[model samples]
Target: MIENTSSVNRVAVAILIAACLFMLVPLAVAFVTATLDYPTFLRGGVTIIPGTHFFDNVIEVWQLTRLPRQIFNSFVTALGISLGKMFLAFTTAYALVFFRSRYTIFIYAAVLATIMLPLELMIVTLYQVTANIAEPVNWIANIGGLWARYFGDPLGLKLSLLDTYPGIILPQIATGGAILIMVQFMRTLPRDLARAATMDGASPLRFMFDVVLPLSKGPLIALTLFFFVDGWGKFMWPLIAASSPDMITGVVGLTRLDFGEEAAIPNYPLKMTGAFMVSIVPLVIIAVFQRRIVRGLTYMDR
Candidate 1:
């Protein structure tokens, strides 16, 4: 029985290794393909063997178009999305967990419902909203502008978020999973902790920032990683919202590269190189913080 069990365990380990490698096939193809020369790439459907044009293809991909600008735009937008989502989720979760009222559960339910309505379904609506988005501060600015014009003092608020970074970030910030995770974590905290903080003269906000959030570092960091990855990987929304080349992200730019051109018939290496580079950041982030993620997701008696 012991020998039989040992053999089964070995087989399972082998199978797991095989499955992991199977999952990496596309990534392997991309990297190997990026190394091949244009001519070799055209002839070889999907080369597993690495070739010699790796650096050359990457350099060409970087220089040939607005790839640098597109990458920069993506980084900025992704950072904004992650920070925005974390802020909104943290505040909302805090409110729901600490300041419970008659309608608190209802509000939580409403927010949770939004997770069901993904970006694809609301794409048209979001596009329309973004197309019309203007800062609310502009209303006050308009009055000030007129007053300044009439009285010879100029006050200005020329802010329109549409087709801009802020516009791209805002619509994507309505996150429900973060709130759910936070609320669940908070519920596990001892009521005596809150009472002790209250007695020690900490205001609700102060307690939240100092106590609750400090205790929640693990979960917050994990969620931040997830949010950053999701934000960086966004393609469809950015594609639809930002038609201008200057406004588009790396994903959109690479996808829209002029594959129609005759030269692009064998330009797979350059394209693959760009794609690998774009994916490298997220992959590195996950690898570095994977342990934190596992800890954060594990339910413990905190």
Candidate 2:
């Protein structure tokens, strides 16, 4: 007998194929426009075939904003944010899962509540906070200075994360989604396994390091790929937080590429080239770990 689900499978496959084609339209435009000259792009919305200035446009994009420096800064910021989120999420999940406390659920709920309050809602406050990190540092420094008057010379250190890597990474490092993923995965883990590890004299930290982490490889790989994509694509927070040209990221550079000699005109080809280059990191990560990402995502409750 024929399978009854065959018709549904066909419909689903058809939808997916159509969606892929729909998504490819913009990519096709970007590639076409990336190669075209100013005149061709102005005359036509998007060029159908490649033009010779592809390399020239690519070079112009590189020179415009010191593209290499922006790439380096973006890579640093993205990697740092990804690692920081994963670290915090893992630790938070461990505390919520293996350890039992009266306020445990409340604490987890509080953290999860951040999902509703996105960075856009708090950008102004966060900006003020980042701009004024030096105040607390200076306050502590003053205390040390007073102490040093009676003791040895006071050690003075001025700290402000504004326009710095840590500043960019820290504000964006809140890992609500990652924590949720880890918590779900951990729940699927056998409680007896952790108990046995404990009976064998494994400390909580040891159990996590030796037991939970290894079993978490699937989710870890999945989250890493997901986090890398999100981190690499982060724009607004980095834009406001890192106002200095010296610390500006690749995504931030993308915002500046839309302008030309006048507000009415924009360097479409060059902007497309810059946009294409900016996308390379996430594309590479997705291509390489696409399979692991799929497996890890579906690993929940398994």
Candidate 3:
């Protein structure tokens, strides 16, 4: 028995150490790359001196590239999409889990099917549809201040919906992946609580807000964190949907460095610096709310 326990402990320690190294490697590379001297950056890989140009690089990226605007646009677009999806998810999950109907299984299956269809394969058709619809609607909405930035059309600008905020936010909300997650979380919820709420004369909306919404804090936080990261880090969709530099997501913007049209060699150091700047929000979100997420998961498990 003692020998078996010792073997298990050694295996656990080995696994833990390996996992820690796996997680730390990328971070180590990013940090090392972020601080490399520009001239010597191409010599090979991994330098550790911590660049003096960190602030200069950040300022240039922020001022010249309009990273701040991109960040803001991404935040607004992502928040709107995330909230919209969450609301849809919550209601759909609530109905699917709490209500019964002949078509319930069919509806559940249909929702599940969406998860299997990757977004990358669907972009071309999705973009065409978005572009077609955005014309008239875009014309109607861009009459005011920042509205023109997103939905404006004058002097034959034609109100570009392609590579714009609405273009990104609309399709994301309809996908229903987040809704599925919420639904899965909702399934484990005891049916008794909902029944009790109904017995106490609570209406559906009231119960959703009061009972389901309150209990769903964990999934909500987790989803929000996940969505925030997804929205913040999104590259391909933003690239496809929004062409303007001001609308670029962090991942997309960082990728532009490698095109190397202007520079002689790839500016890995600058690229890494920009990456770190973009990564700040997701890190902050995780740092602050990770405990809540763990707690929420624990609650759900119980």
Candidate 4:
């Protein structure tokens, strides 16, 4: 039992409202700015007052840019990344948790260590690997100059993933944080669950699919939405990986909107309009699944 003081409760409510306003005010301003026309925006820069030209700005951006195609690309990339990360994290966590061995802890530690080394820190090397995925194969084939002696030249193979969907999704799927979360969640399950499954003569894979998977549905859904949003918002890697405008993600595509001309003011309203358009999909997703996300993250159902 807990006692709640009325004063404390009122103070907490006030703080929550203030925090909400802090987050929402910027978004409100952006939406209001997006609603303004070029002339109106120029007259009153970044005003909180909403205008009627929101649809007009949206239409102009749609007509002038490749945002539609880029949005599709972002959806595909985000979907792939979400699915791939879930699969890898679930399977790896299952093995680490259920399969007892002397090396299990070591393996988990190794996976956990990767969290400190993010993709941004190793992007240059990652780019090289993506540029020629077959480089490792070529190196192994020519080890000790054996291939060179046999063929009179070293083995040369080239298989680049640059500008491809796999290139964008593959590098990002190996998430240690996801695996760590799954592992911790799985560890909380009763040992009797596994024992009962074994007594019922269920195989490892059967138990995982029928029991673990059902129990993990909430976390999986949460991670999927989380990863989808993360992938959708990716800018630097997508910009670097995709050489062509057609292959860029929506966030990267937004940077292509340039209304500045010779001695002309930059079109803030149109740029905000593009930002709003690019952000709507993920916003809708979060809005629809807000409860599930909260429950999943907190393991409230469990």
In the range 1-302, model 3's lDDT, one tens digit per residue, is 43458888899999999998998788778877777756767775676555566676677667656566767776877787777777788788899989979999999889878888877889988787677775555555555544657545342334446767777887877655776777778878888998899899999899999998988887887676667667777677788887777777666766664423366667777777778887878788878877776665455522
**TM-score leader:** 4
Clashing pairs in 1: none
Q: Candidates' TM-scores?
A: 0.85, 0.85, 0.79, 0.93
Model 1 lowest lDDT segment of ten: 132-141
* Candidate 1 lDDT: 0.82
Which residue pairs collide in model 2, if any? Answer: none
Q: What C-alpha lDDT, on a 0 to 100 scale, does residue 123 get in candidate 1?
A: 91
- Ranked by TM-score, the better of candidates 1 and 3 is 1
TM-score of 3: 0.79
The reply for model 3, stretches above 4 Å from the true place, is 1-3, 36-46, 134-160, 258-263, 297-302
Instruction: Give the range where candidate 2 is weakest over 10 consecutive residues by summed lDDT.
Output: 256-265
Model 1 vs. true fold: TM: 0.85
Model 4, residue 259: C-alpha shift (Å): 4.2
Residue-pair clashes per prediction, in order, are 0, 0, 3, 0
Candidates by lDDT, descending order: 4, 2, 1, 3
lDDT of 2 by residue, 1-302 (tens): 86699889999999999999998889888988899877778877675788888888888777765666887888998888888888888888988998879999899999999999898899988887787766665567668477477666664455567889988999888958889988998898999998799789989889999999988888887887788789888888888888877788988887766434574668788888888888888888888888889889889423
Residue 262 of model 3, lDDT score: 63
Rank by TM-score (best first): 4, 1, 2, 3
